[model samples]
Target: MVAETTLRPADLIAPLFVREGVTSPVPISSLPGVSQLDLASLRSEVAQLVSVGVRSVILFGIPLKKDPIGSGASDPDGIVQVAIRELRQCFGEEIVILADLCLDEYTDHGHCGVLTPTGEVHNDDTLVRYQEVALAQAAAGVDLVAPSGMMDGQVGA
Candidate 1:
């Protein structure tokens, strides 16, 4: 088996949250030193991460708008897309940029899947949404996509 020592800076992937419309960083009480950063601040943060030993980052966007279908998730001008562009421009591919492929943050109900009329999670309908989100992230130039929704058939679908 490969030893832990084989791990290097390139193996580390830092997760960043880009929140909309907050000039200053807003600390997340549950996660210390992990704040919701705006675009400018996110750039600075990426710079800082690169200055250290990190060589990759995974981004999750907190959009300014939330809807039942989580439309903001796939928006080309969404926070995640903007963050990916900014980071690529700032780091010039020096860092591997990955995007979290999900809609929880963009959904007002806080559920990963689309809710049925009876308020139950709808899997098939959600898969369509996930596809859109995946395509959007790909269009945003994300090096990798991670779907964290734990939905069935997620890997194959």
Candidate 2:
């Protein structure tokens, strides 16, 4: 049977990971054929994707340092921010860049929100951090922000 329609590379969003403090690409074993790339590799990777007609990419960052406040996530010079700036500069609005707003990637304890003294998640404090990250990403030319860490009211921000 013949197919009735076609889906092109431009029709989908490529999920890309950029890792700080790495000089080269590191393959994500759990996700075959996908890798966590450094800044230089990220530029090359996006170029390849663009050449293949990929028009959108959602970026996730793996910072060199993960602290209790997840400060790197909101840093103007953070990995994701730098990636966004580089992509926008090199690609010149040719791609739709989205930043993943998940705190776990930036948290030392691997939780999605700030931890209370009692080890409970503090929702409001987390929301403030999420906002900071979003603003920072926006300043870096991210087309969209995805709050995917399952924090309550995150999507509302």
Candidate 3:
């Protein structure tokens, strides 16, 4: 006899992009059906997911500002952090919330971490930013934090 297993909505993880300062949802060309959502739109989208029995999501943030050190990534009121709080309040353990922890989108350089004077990535410096981001996400009550740092030995750092 063979045992059969099937995929279900509850096991799927939806990736949502939250962009700061957006009043309306903006389509992402690379992702045909996915859009960078404003906070209001984000709530709506997650609601639909819950209705469909989707129990988990991962969020990526696009902040309104970009600086050399990615200050917004660790800011308490940053887009992703704000989303985490809102979702937690509304969902309250009904769904799993994960934050995509990275600085690529928050930094003007668009690199995962800080760069050195010679334009090479400064690993130690970038890890500091990641630590701050992880802390902020934890404080916001995220269920999980996945680093998008794209660096070798990121966890060890």
Candidate 4:
């Protein structure tokens, strides 16, 4: 009857993967019990999380369009931005929404940032992209933006 540590639902932050142009939730082979959800599914899932006291969530997006600049990463109408807007409209302030600020999922080469001609990651260039992403997330009503990946000067940028 003596438990040294206690775990609560509120202590957990659910991570949700959202894919563009998907009609149904697609199961992730690598992540057990997790699926890439569509817009409708994402909304439902967030509602469920709030119902259970899981008040925080981090969102990752799989965009339908990818480019060298990963333009979708900072688009106001991007998948993550769209999700944030929907979630905010759905739950208001009942839940905290955090976006996974990265370009890997949105980049054609799967790199976290723009690459040089020799295929090297451009830290300074990437920082500018990160700034764009941060601004987009902030405009989308995201409670926080967690910069993902190992880009230099990311947190400060």
The lDDT for every candidate, in the order shown, is: 0.88, 0.93, 0.93, 0.94
Candidate 2's residue-wise lDDT over 1-157, tens digit each?
9878989999989999999999999999999999999999999999999999998999999999999989999999999999999999999889999999978889999898889999888999999999999999999999999888788788897
- Candidate 3 positional error at 28, Å: 0.7
How high is each candidate's TM-score?
0.93, 0.95, 0.95, 0.96
11, model 3: CA deviation in Å? 0.4
Instruction: Indicate the TM-score of model 4.
Output: 0.96
The order of the candidates by TM-score, greatest first, is 4, 3, 2, 1
- Cα lDDT for residue 74, candidate 1: 89
- True-vs-predicted CA distance for residue 134, candidate 1, Å: 0.7
Error of 2 at 3 (Å): 11
lDDT of 3 at 80: 97
The residue-by-residue lDDT of candidate 4 on 83-157, one tens digit each, is 999999999998989999999998999999999999999999999999999999999999999988789899999
Q: What lDDT does model 4 reach? A: 0.94
Candidate scoring better on TM-score of 2 and 3: 3
List clash counts for every candidate, in order. 0, 0, 0, 0
Model 3, range 1-21, lDDT digits (tens) per residue? Answer: 999999999999999999999
Which residue runs does candidate 3 get wrong by more than 4 Å?
1-3
lDDT of 1 by residue, 1-157 (tens): 8756677766799889999878978899999979999988888888888888788999988998899989999898889988888888888879999998888999999899899999988999898898888888888788998999888877677
Model 3 has how many clashing residue pairs? 0
Maximum-lDDT candidate: 4
State residue 149's C-alpha deviation in candidate 1, in Å: 0.6
